[model samples]
Target: MTKVISHVGFSTTARAGDLATLEDSIRRIVDLGADVAELALFGEDLIAGGRIIESRAKRLVEICAKFDIRYSVHGLIVSNFMDAAHLDWQKAVAKAMLELCRRIGADVLVQHSGQMPIGPRPMRERYDALEREALSEIADIAGKAGVRVALENIFAVADTEYRQTPSEVAETVRAVNHPALVGLIDFSHGYIETTRIGADFRAEIRAMAPVAGHLHVHDSFGRPYTMSKFYYTSEAIALGIGDLHMPLGWGDLPFDAIFDEIDPLPGTALIMEIGERFEAERADCLAKARDLAERVNRRFAADAA
Candidate 1:
């Protein structure tokens, strides 16, 4: 059976700051049969304390032991455009974070490649360099820690129109040329990233068959013109893109078919990266994700029969 990890489980945008309240949050996620609980790598507490917070890392590992829930991964390596030195600092921070992840027995780390420049001075050159830096850093940190580092796809149409194509995203990974440097295919971002690959979601996954390790599964209904904003999600809704990251059943993403498509022979796992603020709505999201996963499994079983 394909394992599902609940993404940003305890840290919805509405309550991202309240990460200390994770006991109840983790209980709910584990109750839903999720294999892992993904938490944002940083919190206000981290902000106040410092990067190498051993106390925080110890608490994370303890919670996992108490709940029998593994800490999968969640983090954004701080990147800066104006100062390339930030990249080096972020790399050190990322390495330290992965060390924390290792201490907690977490398995995967998601980091971002730098954004494109606004005025465009050799963007391909800059992005490629950043990716190379990320890859080198991942090999040293995540690989050494035995945690996978997946580079996620970013799509902000308004922000310099950077990374509007999956090919560009894929090309960056290829350039990185490291084993731990993997691809994170967030469905909604993947849709907005390319005109050619939009809605051919499964094919896009198969295209990056070699490096894709984890999936950020969410749904959206915005086309370029309708979305003039050009993207949609609970995060986007918070950003005024659409209503919200409506639960699994609320969107038009062909999730069941997508589930059928992922073989994960190369280590890819599905993370239900949905967002709902209310406990009632979150419960609904869990039920739907479990139901959908169960149904897909039954179908696969019957097909074998």
Candidate 2:
């Protein structure tokens, strides 16, 4: 069965200064009927002065044990591997993250692929080479720690085209060809990138499905046009081109189609990456998400029968 996990990242965004509060916030996720928890590790907390916080790593382990919640860690955004200059720092951070995963008993770590420059400079081939190099090192780290590292698809924004679409992520995984490295599908990111890049959403999902070890499931209405905005603006909402992390049905995503593609897989994680806008209604929203996951599983079983 696919494990349904709730994201504690939204809560952490507010309490980034005080990570201890994550313990309290995550306990709420367990209460909401999620089978697992996804802890978002920002670059600020995980990467500093070329090292990881040993004490904070210990605290994270304690938090998971306290709640008895099986967990995974999302990689830090600031430590992206795309930048050539950040490659050394990124490697250090990756090693640190692997150590943390081992200490905390986390089996999977989701990482965002590096950003693509707005204008062509390093060339796509070269950039891809750099990214592959970074992933190779990370895969080795994860392998040694007995954990898997998932490379996520990040959508392109105005200034930079974070060209790591689902297909690209899959191709990267294949190129890296490491057992410990796999693809991660973020629905919202894939949805937006598909529309922008003129790729079929279903095809994108299918291309990545074979290599995907985890998924970031969230509702995205349309392609976001604005820059540096988290919440959907009034204009964007009216135009329906924003990546709003609303509830499932709140958007026009074809969940039935997505689940259809996922059903045949060997049980990938279904993690809800709801935005902070729905923080107040998190419990209720997650309960509905859990129900949706169960419903999908039942349908798959019925189809198999």
Candidate 3:
């Protein structure tokens, strides 16, 4: 029993165009006792037609190099492998993102799991197969770049018909069977999805824990969004209607129970993805994350004893 989690940190919200802001964000994360920074590279401007802009990439490297923290990249959120028409382009973007990770020395690139298909059963099956094929190729590129691609679980929304459950994502990673491809159990997403589908929440998480190499830890009441109207995110927070990304104690998620039940693989990066609105609570969130990591390590130590 050594430490089960290698890094406990927060995601940075700075955009590519604002290098100064990005530097400040990283400095704040480091000041808050975070050893890792999860860069949210979800903007379209970072990649152009499936290739990273070299100038932007170089600047990012220089900024990140100034910090003593580890790095992880959250790849383009809209790059969907399920979109059969754009699978090749998606693969190209994915490869380019992996190259960016290599350039910036990020060890993990977080990718969202495939979106649910909107057609017949056969079409859904075809999409699943396509995603696996695409990931296999992407994983090969990731391996060559010394980066691990962690497929993250996402919940379904009103517009999006459905999303893969934790078990389904785990199965996909296991099917790919590549060391460079692993599961990322976003607890908030798992809670929302399991609540939507009426599946056992803790059970779904436990099933996926064994394959988890990276984790997005945030607090969300297990409430899915509906057609109800909400003007601001604060309104959603008031009603607890969606993935609020609230601070740990701000939501009713049983984080203690979650850490008690699932043990992610050793060296997993447990990054807190608290929303930007909760910026003032960064120190508190970091402490809670450290406590949970210690709990997991204590459990492992006990098991070994």
Candidate 4:
């Protein structure tokens, strides 16, 4: 069968500013038989004040050269374009991240979908326009660097209104209309958001599949965190609430069904975003992701036939 997914791996859990730990994490991922390693660069201190720290960038490049693994970077989670006050700053950081992608030979840099503080509909519309402009510019930078900017769908919470749904993200990407900009479907986040809004999970995934260039493969019960009181993550796991980021098969996410239906674009990276709590299960999680990718590829081949 033709391959639909080009890479499969887990995100690194190493602490920022620690090259030894980063190397250790990549080495472990390579040992686990993964061909890709996603660098979650948000808190990694690799960039400061919207610029790449030249010394750190050099060291990072050196460290990665020691491994044979491909890379995909998760950009700063707080880089929101919807915030008009800091829009230029956001653009600067995004461009710097694209430069990092080029320096490290990464083809994809993932950014969470834009979110805005809750406000009136007119205000929200303005913010949406700002985001489109920002993403257009960001996409240009990424394209020039030979990288794709993947805008990931995020689940909404009480404090903010995330793009919230796969269709919404798809719409935004289409509006940007840039070849370098594509959708990233984080299935766990999609599950929670779709469940919250009473939408069919599979349908939503299928709708966004065509535009998707990256996938965050993890399991989660279709539950939103709405507890009135504070509790530990263990308690949330017990209740199956929120984005648990559980290892595949540990939660009720229908991976078999979802993969059977959606065919992400060729060369899409199917990354397992399992939390650090499930570290022992990383190998198994990657195995399951490979199996799912096979399923999708088979379907893709059959459709072509």
Candidate 5:
């Protein structure tokens, strides 16, 4: 069975340094009936004052174990391995994050595709070469640590910068072709990408499903295209137009269509990337979200049977 997890995006906020917040969030996730919990750790948690601290990493391990919850780690977005200028620093941070993953018994470490800034020239070969090399090295470390390094697809403001689309991400994962490296599809991002390009959303999910080792489960109101923009409004919020990450059914995303297109794989981690907008009622919202996900899982499983 696929284990559903919920992410606590605390690392991007002031609460990243607060253990109490982390604990409370994890407790809520478990209580919401999730099978696992994911925590995003930033570079600050790995290094400080120009030094690495195993103590801090160990504390996180202790906390997760205390609650008896299975967990995974999402490396900081700044831990980019594609850019040569910051490759060394980013690699170091990524390595430390893998160490944290090992200590926490996390079997997967989710990462964003290497940072490839938008440029004037066509740089596909150059970018692919860099990603291939960097991900290979990262994969070796993850393999040795018994963890898979999952490169998640992201929606780039410039589509050419990185592998943003589902097929593009699947291609990149195949190019790396490492046993310890796999592709992760952010459903919300995939939806936006498919909608923007007039592609079939189910086909997008099908393309990535074979290599999908993990998922960022979320919802959006409408697709955000590269050529246009939509202003935020109270009305828009109610409609869940943007990457709202509201409770599952709050948006118009075709969750059933996407799920039915592919069978759930064993050991796949589904992280509910519910944005912090629901912080005031996070517990209530998460409970509802979990219920929806469970219903979908059962429906899909029965369909497959």
Candidate 6:
């Protein structure tokens, strides 16, 4: 059975007292028949002034267990805000996340690779060393806690001086070469990251074959590809350029072929890693996920036939 996990990003709410919001979001996801919920740590309660505590972890665990949902961590994108090359904060956050994952019974942690190293070293050399060391350390720590780490490759426009390609995602995963760490592939991010690589999506997935741990599944989005001309951040956030993390099949993410490829991989988790869901779109999104899963199962059934 292919299990579908929903990240709380679906609700766009990530606060501590936002329990009511998360409860409502989980209800909708459960109603859609998903068996897992991804808990993001950056929203509200999980992290405070650059640290984590037991109370926040306990609250999250109780909520997920109440819904009979498996949990994972997703909001630990400390790299985007920090110096990726330095990696002091990245390692710290990863360690905190593994502890949270252990306490929550979530064996998976999904996160983006973040912007590449912005240091004084050679670009590729710096990226290679930083990613290798950081992920290797993360893997060792997570292995101790019996958790898996999945690195997501997101698209972003740089100040021209600070940008890294998605193929580096494949590159770094290969460089690390660990069983505890793997790749988390998203449609939009893969497309943007590999735009310059000339490799197809199937090739991208295959590249991470040895360490392909979990998946952040979604359909293609229609985000703006146009640069904001005035602002780098605006350009990065433009439509379809980055992973806005829309609902499955709602965006143009090309899941049909992608799913077909992964359908053969036994036990690979499919996480519906959408950004934020609004009250207006909640019910419909749930219905769509159910319908999409059924559609996937039927194809598998027919393929088996």
The C-alpha TM-scores of every prediction are 0.75, 0.85, 0.95, 0.95, 0.81, 0.75
lDDT of each: 0.58, 0.71, 0.86, 0.85, 0.69, 0.60
Which residue pairs in candidate 3 have backbone atoms (N, alpha carbon, C) closer than 3 angstroms, thus clashing?
A: none
The lDDT of model 3 is 0.86
* Model 6 Cα lDDT, one tens digit per residue, 1-305: 44332222232246555766776667766665556666656664675544676676677677777777666777565554225545676666667778778887887877677564355657657655666777788889888898888877666554333444445676777778877877766656676555534456567655554355566655555343444444543344344455555556555666556554443233445566554543456556556555545554566667776
Tens-digit lDDT track of model 3 for 17-107: 5767777778888888898999877652567888788887788788889999999998877767777788888888889889889988999
* lDDT for each residue of candidate 4 in 9-65, tens digit (9 for 90 to 100): 988875756877888878888899997999877756888888789988999899889
TM-score, predicted candidate 6 vs. hidden true structure: 0.75
lDDT of 6 at 270: 57
Rank ordering of all candidates by TM-score, starting from the highest: 3, 4, 2, 5, 1, 6
Show where candidate 2 strays beyond 4 Å: 1-14, 43-46, 118-122, 159-162, 226-241, 263-267, 275-284, 291-305
Model 2: per-residue Cα lDDT over 1-305, one tens digit each: 33332222222232664666676667666776666677776632755655877777677677767876667777776557778976888778778878777887878888887776755655877888888988898898799898899888877766366576788789999999999988888888888888877788888888987788777777767575654453536555556676766766667888766765553234456677774456676676666656656665676667766
Better of 1 and 2 by TM-score: 2
Q: Which stretches of candidate 3 lie over 4 Å from their true place?
A: none
User: In terms of TM-score, how similar is model 5 to the real structure?
Assistant: 0.81
Candidate that beats the other on lDDT, 1 or 4, i.e. the better one: 4
Task: Locate the minimum summed-lDDT window of 10 residues in model 2.
Answer: 5-14
lDDT of 1: 0.58
**lDDT by residue for model 5 (77-114), tens:** 65566688877777777787788888888888988876
Sorted on lDDT, best first, the list reads 3, 4, 2, 5, 6, 1
TM-score of 3: 0.95
* TM-score of candidate 2 relative to the true fold: 0.85
